[model samples]
Structures are given as structure tokens and as C-alpha cells.
Target: MQKVRVLIVDDSALVRKVLTTMLESDPGIEVVGTAADPLIARDKIKLLNPDVLTLDVEMPRMDGLTFLDNLMRLRPMPVVMVSTLTERGADVTLRALELGAVDFFTKPPADLANTFMDHAPEICAKVRLAAGAKPRERAAVSKLDVAPRLSADAVLPLAQTPGTRGGTRIIAIGASTGGTEAIRVVLEAMPPTAPPIVITQHIPAAFSGPFAARMDSCSAMRVMEARDGQPIQAGHAYIAPGSQHLLVMWDGAKHVCRLHDGPPVNRHKPAVDVLFRSMVASVGAATIGVLLTGMGDDGARGLGELKEIGAPTLVQDEASSVVWGMPGAAWKAGAANEMLPLDAIAARLLALAHTPVSAAASRVGT
Candidate 1:
């Protein structure tokens, strides 16, 4: 097979050299060229036509974000961001993903050559994944300028008449790539009385805290990192902690969150599959599963299991997803009861949660 051609873009010679060496070690990848700035990188991109580009967040001539905006607008391709592991770096990296970056890696501190060495293999793998990734259409920047408003088309209204049976109301959500922003959009639309929400997102350890905090500040529900044994309750959103497995457990009266330090599932510690599986085992027919935009099929089978148990499942439609892999997989598996756009997801969740238990039970039996 032909090797994946890569272009390295960073102002730092050391970073370029180190990254090039590490990436070249993988026989499947080839370093086509290196550029110290976006202007030079632009010229190189036209000439090299590489399969992927590894970009540094900070550059001399043009910042990575500005370069990214231009690149996506003029000629879109897969780009992976290399960023520092600071809080600011996390924020920028998250934005970069939303701006159409395929993936990101946090470089170790200058003092920690050993740490960088330890993560080199992981970085190399991410580069490979980015090379094979599909580039998403750039999001409309105008949406960012204004606070998002809920459109009638964005939500499905709750059933007006009461049914004989109250329905089981559990929520399962999955996110990756541009999940931070997508999650914020859905969570912000929920009311304070929203049903318990379980979210599985792919994020680094240090960033999850800040991500959750940001969600709490913007959304009506209380948001926090998932703690083992914490009861799942209405008006709360539980985020799977970074680098750990978050599964649902039952304590008879209420559902509890459990954290596991087990091996990574589907190449993600807090994999959507792990959480969805636990929900399948614990809540079964009483669950409502949602598969969101992400880069892989991690949650497809678990969502299928939930569907098999008479639970309703939803997938984010491809047009609105940053990456449609996860939701697409669930849809293909026939796991999703509804396939809707991002804006419609919150309303669907609310409508499902509010369904009477008897009606939900009858639907499950059907």
C-alpha cells in the first residue's frame, strides 16, 4: 500500500524535527515536507499535496486558527493540531476541532523529554488516524456571533395527551471531535427538570474539568465530572471523566455512576460503548440512547443493544455532525429510532423523557 504523505507545520525547529522523526518511524507514514509558518505551508501544500498536515497552534507569520480558516475555505483537507497542554491550549484545541481539525495532540512540557517520548507512539497513531479522516465542511461562523435560539423545527413536541403507562426515561449521549460545542448546544436547550443525562466524550484528563465547568456555566442543568457511586438524578448531567471508563450502575432506588480504570475500550478510555453497555444492562427498556457526532463506531453496538431492549435511540444526522462516523454507524445498525439533526436532538430527548411510563412500556413491548 502507498504510505500516507504528511506535511509538518511548526515554527519550532525542535518540534518539527521531533515530530518528523517520530512520524517517520511508522513505516506507513512519510514526511513530505516541513514549513515554519502557514504562508510557507500554503505554498508547500500546493506543491507536496500531502495526505495530512500536522500544525502547531502558534506560528510566526499566521496563527494556526487563521491559517485553518483560510485552508478550509480555500482547499479543505485533514489537519491535526499539536498544542501545549495548558488550559488555554485546551480551549484552542477544542475550537480547532470545531473549525474542522481531524484531531489534536498536547505536546509535553519543555522540561519533560521523557514524557514526550512516552507519548510519541500515541501521537504517531493519531497522525495516522488523521490522515485517513474525512474533512468536514466548515461550520458557519455567524452562528457563533449570536446566542443560539431554539427553532420549532429543532424540537419535537412532547405528546400532549397522557397515556396509560409512564415510559422509562434514560438518556445516552456520545460525542467526539467537535463534541464540546455540540454537547453544549444540546445541554443548554434542556430545562432544569430535564431527565438525567449520561454523556461519553473523548477528551484529555486535564481538560475534562474545564469542559464540564464551561458546560455548567452555560447550561441549565448542573454539570460535573462523573464520580463513582454518585446517583444519577434529574436536572444533572454526568460527564465521563477523562482516561477512565464511566458505566452506569443501579442502587435499587436510583442509578449510580461508576468509574473504571480498565483498559481503553475502542481506543477511548471513556468510550461511548462502555457507558451504553452499562445502560443496556441496568436500565434496558427504560433508556433513551443518543449517538452523536464522532469519528468511530464505538457506540453502535451498545446502542443496538439498547434498541433490542425496547429503548428509544437517536442519532445526529450527518448534515449537522462534525464527524458522522458514530451516528452513522448506529443508524446503519438500525439502532436509532430517530435520526435527526443536531438542533433537533434536545427536543427529542425532552419529548422521550416526558412520555408516560405506561406508554413507554407498551411501546417497548411492541
Candidate 2:
């Protein structure tokens, strides 16, 4: 197999050097060249024709966002953003994702070299994934790999019993890689009176608040980061904080949000499995699980479990996904009741949300 060719663009020489070393540590990836800014990157892109580009959020000649917009409009390709762990960085990185970047990783504010080195596996893994995620209207072609990881049981017990109470239906969604925009598309189409929605999107801790705010601006339902003990309510959507695992717990009379700061499961702090498993225990068959575009099988097992318990589940089809890893895994495992395109997902979800749980179960795969 051919190695993935990469071009590094950063204003700082140290950053460029560190990123090169970090990415090249993987035998599957090769750093073709480095550029100090987007202007130089433009020239290198034409000359080197690298398979993927690792872009810095801030640069000297031209900012990454501007370049990204121009690139997507003119010549679309997979790009991964490298950003700082700050409010501004978080906001900028989110915008980058909107501009068609496949994914992003935050640069530590301090101890740059050591921190970057420590997360080498993740950085290289993202680049490799990006190489296969051909940006505009294409299915991703890569298979992702990582070190062995703990499952949801590492955070919550699998045998926890669910309450037998009947209540309003709930929607639980999970995504990674190109999730930000896919989620925005889904939420924007939802009505203000839609079922209460819970989301777990793999992201850096600092980015979740801004992500929720961004969704709130466009979505009909109020969107906010989940808070511990917050009551689940309709006309609102809760996003899991990037640092903590968000869980739905039966607080006797009602279900409420619970935040767990447990070790990373499936190599993600807010693993989709943790959230899905929690809903299985808290709401049982009353939940509608939706898995969107993401790399890796973080939510596959939990989604299958939901199906086993008679809950309805769906996944984004590969033709519309930025990376098909998660949803494909679930589909292959026969976990999804339906595999729908991104534009069609919200409508199907709304239809299922209104149907009685028993009727929805009967209507599965229809």
C-alpha cells in the first residue's frame, strides 16, 4: 500500500517541525513538505499534490479559514486543522470544520513539544483518516486503527436495570469526524416541540460550549452543553461536554443528566457508547438512537444493544458520510433499523419520534 502524503502548514517553525515528527512516526504516513503560511501552502499544494494537508488555525500570510474556504470552493480535498486549546481557537476550529475540513486536533497551550509527542497516535490517526475522506460529496475510504481501549463498562456497569416507566420519547445521537456540520443539518430541521435530544460528538473540551452555541443559533430547539442534574426537557437539545461523559440517569421521579469524569472509553472521553448505554438503562425502549458520520466504531456496540432491547436505531449512509467507519460498523453488525442519507435523517427521526414505541418497533426497517 502507498503511504499517505501530507503537507504541513504552520506559522511557527517549531510547530511545523514537531508536527512532521509526530505524523512521520507512523509508517503509513509521510510528510511531503512544510509551509510557513497559507500563501506558501498554495504553492506547495500545486507542486507537491499531497494526499492530505495538516493546517494550522493561525498563520502569517493568510489565515487557515480563509485558505480553507478558497480551497474548498476551487479545489476540494481533505484537510485537518491544528488549533490551540482556547476560546478563540475553539471557535475558529469549529468554523474550519464548517468550511469542509475533515477533522481537527487541539494544540496544548503549554508544553507544546511534549504534549504533541504524547498524542502522536491520535494526530497520525486523524491524518490517515483524512486522507481517505475526500471532502466534497465522497465516501471515505480508510479503515482506522488505534491501541486497545476500554469499553463503556469501564465507566458504567452494563447490567444496570432500566426503569419500566413509560414517558415521552427521547432521541440520542452520536458522531465524530464530520459530525459538527451533519449535526447542525439535523438540528436545524427539527421543530421546537421535538423530543428531547441528547448528543455526544467527539471534540476537545474547550470546543463543546461553542459548538452548542453555534447549534443554538441555527436550530429551532434551544441547544446547550449538558449540566449535571439538569432535567431532560423537550424543545431543547443537550450536548455532552467534551471533558466528561454525559449519562442519563433515573433520578427516581424523572430522568436527569449525569456527568462522569471516568477514564476515556474507546479512546474518547465522552464516548458515544457511554451515552448510548446510559440511555439504555435510563429510558430503555423509549429511546431513538441515531449514529452519524464518524471514524471508528465507538457507538457500534451500544447501538446494537439498543436494537436488541427493541429500540429504533438509524445510521447515516456511507454515500453521505465524511468517514463511514462508525455507521458502517453498526450497519454491518445489523444494528441499524434504517440507513438513510443525511438530508433524509431528520424527517425519519421526526416520524419515529411521534409514533408509539410499539408501533415504531413494528415499523422498523420499513
Candidate 3:
């Protein structure tokens, strides 16, 4: 594979030097150029045509957000934003995602002497994902594929009432790469009475809160970051905090969120595997596992575990996925029972979730 060519754009000379070095240190990535601000970056972008760009969210003459808006509007390409780890910075970085930026890496504290080196692996992964991500127009981002619509009848027979047959139903979802937007669309499409959802998205610590708040705004159900030991509830979605791995724990009859500080799985702290494995042990047949677009195969083996124990698993089809790595791997692993587009998965979940527990269990073996 060709090294992903990168151009570093930052106002701070030290940042430019450090970021360029950090990215180039990886054999898979090559630093093509460095610029102090968007102006120099613009000229270099045309000249060098780097495959990926790491841009500071705050820049000198032209604000980073403004430059991003123009860049996407004119020439669509994969770009990753470098943001400060603050509330304000988090919100702006979320905006950059909506503006077609592939992903972002938050800057460590000013006191952290080796910020780039400390987080070098994660930064390089983000750049690699960005370089391979599909570029779309700012105002006309591609809509998710919703082919072969599914209905409630597909999962639950109309002759039976789902309310009478089921125990507590829960939806557990995981995503990375293009997750933020994909998650928003899924949540927005959800009805008011959908089952409780626990999500593990690959995000940095500072951005998780803001990302949840952003999802809450666009979604009908309340969405927030998972707090340790918080009980999972219906009509709400809990997001795994960036630094912790989220798990579903059964406390007596109810399910709750559990956070772990273990080493990263598949190089992701809030790994999809952790959540899926937890649900397999905790929720059993009532768990609906949905794996969306992501860059790596973090969720494949875990989803396979879920499938092993008679749990339903769905993966976002490649026609709709931004990278198709996670879902594709899961499908190849015989983990995914249904491969649906982003728009169709929600309907399938709602349909299957409404099925009575007894009936759901019977179908689980399929």
C-alpha cells in the first residue's frame, strides 16, 4: 500500500514540527508538507495534493472552520481536524465532522511535553482512516442506503402481541470512522419508544460529552455518555466515554453500564468488542447487536461471540459504510446475521426488538 501522504497545518511552529514528525514516523504515513496557516496550506494543497490533511481547528488569518467550509464546498477531500481538548473545541470539532472532515484528534494539555508521541498511534490511525474515507460535497453529503425496507412483521408475527411475550429488550450498537453522522441518522430515525440503546463509538475523551449532546439534540430519544454503574433505561441511548471500555452488566434483573480501564482492544479504548461481549453474557437473547461503519475489525470477534450464543447481529452493508472494515470483517466471521444499509438496520431492530422474549429466543437459533 502507498504511504498516506499528509500535510500538517497549524499556527504554532512547534505544533507543525511535532505533528509532521509524529505522522512521518509511521512507515504507513509520509508528511508531504507543513504550513503555518490555511493560506500557506491552501497553496500547498494545490501543489502537493496530499492524500490527507491534519488541520488545526484554530488558525491565524483564516479560521480553521471557515477554511474547512470553503475547502469542502470547492474541492472535496479527506481532512482531519486537530482540536484542543475543551468544551468549546469539542463543539467546533463536531461541526467540522458535519462539514465533511473524516475524523479528529484532540490536542493534549499544553503541559504534556510529548503530546504527539504519547498519542502517536491514535493520530496516525485517524490520518489513515481519513485518507481512505470517501470524500463528499459539504452541502450534498451522500444519504445512507435504505434499500429493501423491513417492517415489524418481519421479526414478530402480527397474530401475536409482542408486549405479552418479552422481557426487557436492549439495543447495543458500536461504530467508528464515520460513526458520528451515521449514529445521528440512526437515532433520528428511531421512534420514541425504541428500547434502550448502549453505544460504543471510537471517540476521544473530551469529545464524547459534546458528541452525545449533539446526538441528543437531533435524536428523539435522550442520549448521553455512559456513567459508570448507570442503569440502562428505555428511550435513552448511552454512549461509552472515550477513555473507558463500556460493558453491559446485569444487576439482578436490570442491565447497567460498566466502565473498564483495561488496555485498548484493537487499539480502541471504547472498543466495540468489549460492549458486544458484555451484552452476550448479560442480555443473552434480548440483545440486538448493530455494528456500523468503522475502519478496523474491532467488533468482528465479539460479534461472532454474540452470534454463537443465539443473539441477533446486524452489520452496515458496504454500499453504505464509510470504510466497511468492522462490518465487513464481522460478516466474514459469520457474526452478522443480516447485512443491511444504514437506513434499513433501524427498522429491522425495531421489528426484532418488539418480538416477545419467547419468540425472539426461538428465532435466535436461526
lDDT of each: 0.79, 0.90, 0.82
lDDT of 3 by residue, 1-366 (tens): 799999999998888877877777678888989999999999999999999988899989999999999999988889988899899999999898888888888877774446456777677778988887886566311222223423222221222211211257888898998888888879998877889999999998989999999999998898999998898888999999998988888777577889888767776778888887777667776778889998878888778776666667899998787778899999998888899989888889999887775676577556
Error of 1 at 140 (Å): 40
The candidate that achieves the highest TM-score relative to the unseen native structure: 2
| CA displacement after TM-score superposition, residue 88 of candidate 2 (Å) | 0.4
After superposition, the stretches of candidate 1 with alpha carbons farther than 4 Å from their true spots are 1-4, 25-28, 73-75, 110-168, 361-366
Better of 1 and 3 by TM-score: 3
Question: lDDT for model 2, on a 0 to 1 scale?
Answer: 0.90
Model 2, span 28-112: residue lDDT tens: 9999999999999999999999999999999877889899999998889899999988999999999999889999998888888
Which ranking of candidates, highest lDDT first? Answer: 2, 3, 1
Order the numbered candidates by TM-score, best leading: 2, 3, 1
Which runs in model 2 stand beyond 4 Å of their true positions? 137-148, 362-366
lDDT of 1: 0.79
Clashes of each: 8, 0, 1
Error of 1 at 190 (Å): 2.3
Off by over 4 Å in 3: 111-113, 139-166, 358-366
